[model samples]
Target: MASNDPDREEEAAAAGEDEDTGAQVAPIVTLSEVAVTTGEEEEDALLDLKAKLYRFDKEGNQWKERGTGSVKLLKHRETGKVRLLMRQVKTLKICANHLVLPSVKIQEHAGNDKSCVWHASDFADGELKEEMFCIRFGSVENCKKFMETVEGIAESSEKNEEKESKDASDAAGLLDKLSVHESKTEKAPEEVPAAAVKADDETEK
Candidate 1:
């Protein structure tokens, strides 16, 4: 049986209106938030300039522009080595999807009073295996920032490796110490039993 209570009906109506309002407003709020976040991300990406990527042409003996993109560092999971990954903005038939330059070597050179040049070498098996790639930034500040970022990652990786090596050495030393202590304990038990046997023999005589 339904009771026709005026207050209860008014409360029910109010709840329904709230639900309707929420349903109408939720999409607008979500869309606005998403728009703001996406805008910020795009702006941040733009801050990383889309510089021209060039590689040395051995045949022509000149640096040739391959594509335009931002350079990124990729770390190998198994080997824990940092590799240079060039993400191309425009797709090129000659270039791979992402140009993977493994074991990259970076060198910075001063171009002029205003600009700077960066040279990246991709090596394999201790030899220069690929053409030397060059990056020319418009200003010294940009070039320095790029170089510092790369150098920071390399230094971090080296520190991590050193820490792991030191930890392993410490663990080995601890195990060796435990083994020596155990051996001493076992020898102590044998010595005590031998002395007890000698004392008993002397008492019997």
Candidate 2:
């Protein structure tokens, strides 16, 4: 017969290995710690952010951000275009419920004929009140292209939202109609038996 031993030694060894692995892993991060900025000066910072966000996942480190980072201007840079420097500001450890990107509003610069413009309105920084903080330092082609890309994404999102809302409303209406129909069906009068009616009629005659 084969041995039914518990393999105590092997189990202990495996438990020890698990403890060591856990120690090697870094601690979980809080949401406040993640930040999105206009420009990140070092690649290391970006790497660190990614590690904190995706550590729970099994995938090897990806260069992409766990949150959304959009680049919207006129275009990707023509002959003399300069890219905008953007960064993220995090406040707490990221969880499935919380989005990777912060919720901030931003606007582009408004100039008669200027490229490479930065608009304070494009950013969510509340203290900067004046419109002058915006700038345009990119080429018109690049700015237009960037804006179009962002607009496309926004349009798609809006469409999805609209569709979802419409579906929900339709479902609710159908349910209401069904409920009404069911109530009417249940309240309907029952038919009298023909034999009972005939017997009563003969008795009366």
Candidate 3:
């Protein structure tokens, strides 16, 4: 025989409610926030622009569509090394090898001023070569914006590299100067004996 106590039934129901509340999940994270975080962690991009990628056909002397992609100007947070990332839309493929912001150059087409050419070296062939890529904007203003953004990133990257090189050179120069000073200090006693001998000879004369 079991006694069905009202208080006991209420207590069991309350425990079940408590368990359900405890199992309730936290709110889901948004995709945009995740993307921003990933971008910051991976590249710390200075410039990110959407553009249609084209490869210049040397034989036909015309530009062909590679895909629509985003060009990102990124810098290594630790090394300060600049790199360009061409990431295709709806694809996991990314072109990031031997990419330098300084190597990126933009120019207007000879026949059509509205059409712009974005050129950069693709060293995936393991050789020194220039690979041309064209990006056309809907309006002249958009074209200018793209050009200015790329150019600005390139110029800033060049300056940063130059400054780093100069700093390294200066540090090397300082080390060399310190080494020379140490060597001179170590030889000072040898020179003193020579000077003393010369003084003694002069005194005897």
Which candidate tops TM-score? 3
Candidate 2 residue runs with Cα over 4 Å from true position: 1-85, 88-108, 112-137, 187-205
Candidate 2 C-alpha lDDT tens digits along 101-148 = 111122444443332222222223323232222223235554455444
Q: Model 1 residue 151 lDDT?
A: 63
What residue pairs are clashing in model 1?
A: none
Indicate the residue-level lDDT of 196 in model 1.
90
**How close to the true structure is residue 24 of candidate 2, measured as C-alpha lDDT?**
64
Candidate 1 local lDDT, 1-205, one digit each (tens) = 8769999999998998777444344454443334323112221221254455667788999878866665554555555555554556665222212212323345664444332334444442244444666666666687777666666666776687788899999999999999999988774433457889999999999
Instruction: Give the backbone clash total of model 1.
Output: 0
Better of 2 and 3 by TM-score: 3
Q: Would you list the C-alpha lDDT of every candidate in the order shown?
A: 0.56, 0.39, 0.70
Give the lDDT of residue 110 in candidate 1: 43
Q: Ten consecutive residues with minimal summed lDDT in candidate 1?
A: 38-47
RMSD of 2: 21.4
Give the Å error, residue 73, model 3. 2.8
